[model samples]
Target: MDFVDLEPEIPDSIQVSRDIVYKETDQRSLKLDIYKDEFLVEPAPVIIFIHGGSWTTGGKEDYLIYCLAYAQKGYVTASLSYRFSQEAIFPAAVEDIICGIRWIKAHASEYGIDSSKVALVGGSAGGHLAMLAAYTADESYFASGCDENAVSTAVQAIVNIYGPSDLTTDFAVAQGATPKFMGATYDVNPDIYKVASPITYITPDDPPTLTLHGTIDKIVPITQSDFLDKALITNDVIHEYHRLKGWSHTMDASVPVNEYAQKVMTRFFNEWLNGDD
Candidate 1:
């Protein structure tokens, strides 16, 4: 990931801490940008956001505005960064995400975040990482040098935006993105692909999920979310699926659709993360 080329204008009412190092290894250091309403009381619910750039591009800077929007809504939100495919392969991004959550928990008191009420929000490739990270919320997956037992990486809920839930599916294998991230095609690394897929970890005890997908997404088909929705139902895991008809992969093309999706996401996060539900 690279530095955010531009930053969003932050309102005075929101408190922000940019580029805080979450993990530092011999190779590189991972950072995150945090936003929270200054007036928010202690034990505030937190949201960790992951950006989408096909798992190869994008960084915390890309999602500043999105994070701030959630902060303004009274949640402590962090825009997190992870290793790209060029730097490392599968499970590396996953480990970084888990580390980010643990870092947040380790410093929960200073940040005034309610560690137990955290939520994961990501779009595109970030969405995939968010789902996989939340599902693999165990100590064994912690990154090297990070304390696995410092705090649970488990999230109370997840908001996945057009992420591929199953990499073994025809659409995912044909898309080439999953293969690139996994370091090989499914035929050669079926086990890795299965371990990387979030759909494979769905269980009755999994956190509630909210998925939004554009019907005409060329990169990641809406069927990905459809399959996840079905699995969630089969496991009796509470969830909501929003299918944006006539829309494509990126939400920028349709203003109304983007705004509506944001509204839905905001409501879902507020209800689940803020303990309103």
Candidate 2:
């Protein structure tokens, strides 16, 4: 599908607020864009999207379609921008996301957001960060500079699309972006790679997870999601995996593939974010 095919005609009923600063750091102001129904009377569940760019590029605008679609579906959606690997190292992006979540929850009333029914969604590197932030909500390592007790970072659901689960894996170790993001080679700091891996924090108590990956993906590889699936299963966590066949990384860029993902994600979010367990 062409890129134009992915652009939907956003209805007037849906409102968009762009470049809302969620955090202010010495380096820059982290921002996010929010989408919601203008006439929403009741508080709605929130879905935050993180964009993929090997942890070095991309922005909140990358998931505009997702935010609009979910907003029209009676949910408040946000796409956040975090510090890239080029500007900051490993935990910086993670920390920024946690801060973004906390900011969203803190200002939930302004946006008619149901703070308790929040979820995180991301693709590729974004997915990895989403998983890390969601799974380690209670861990202080990532919440270092923020007031950890002020607002909770815990989310109800997680959606990982072609995201790498274990950075310590051979594939991840060999990736140039992986080491760059970590600020060290796997040989120099294996522990950092392990700590940054989303699989490391998986537990039965973690939020329900949904993962989608193309079997033919050469970038992140299908094995990343496979490893995540296995770990989630072993932990008895509620999880779903969609291994799309004959597709490559960023397969969602295709209209049909994106639509399929939207369908699956809508169902997953509705079930887990609506008190359905």
lDDT of each: 0.82, 0.90
Estimate candidate 1's RMSD in Å. Answer: 3.6
Backbone clash count, each prediction separately: 0, 0
Q: In model 2, what are the clashing residue pairs, if there are any?
A: none
Across residues 143-243, which tens digit of lDDT does each residue of candidate 2 receive?
A: 54654347888899999999999999898999999989999999998999999999999989999999999999999999999999999999999999999
lDDT of 2 at 89: 93
Candidate 1 segments exceeding 4 Å error: 1-7, 139-145, 252-254, 275-277
Candidate 1, residue 54: how far the Cα is off, in Å: 1.0
Candidate 2: stretches off by over 4 Å: 2-9, 147-149, 275-277
- The C-alpha TM-scores of every prediction are 0.92, 0.96
Error of 1 at 37 (Å): 1.4
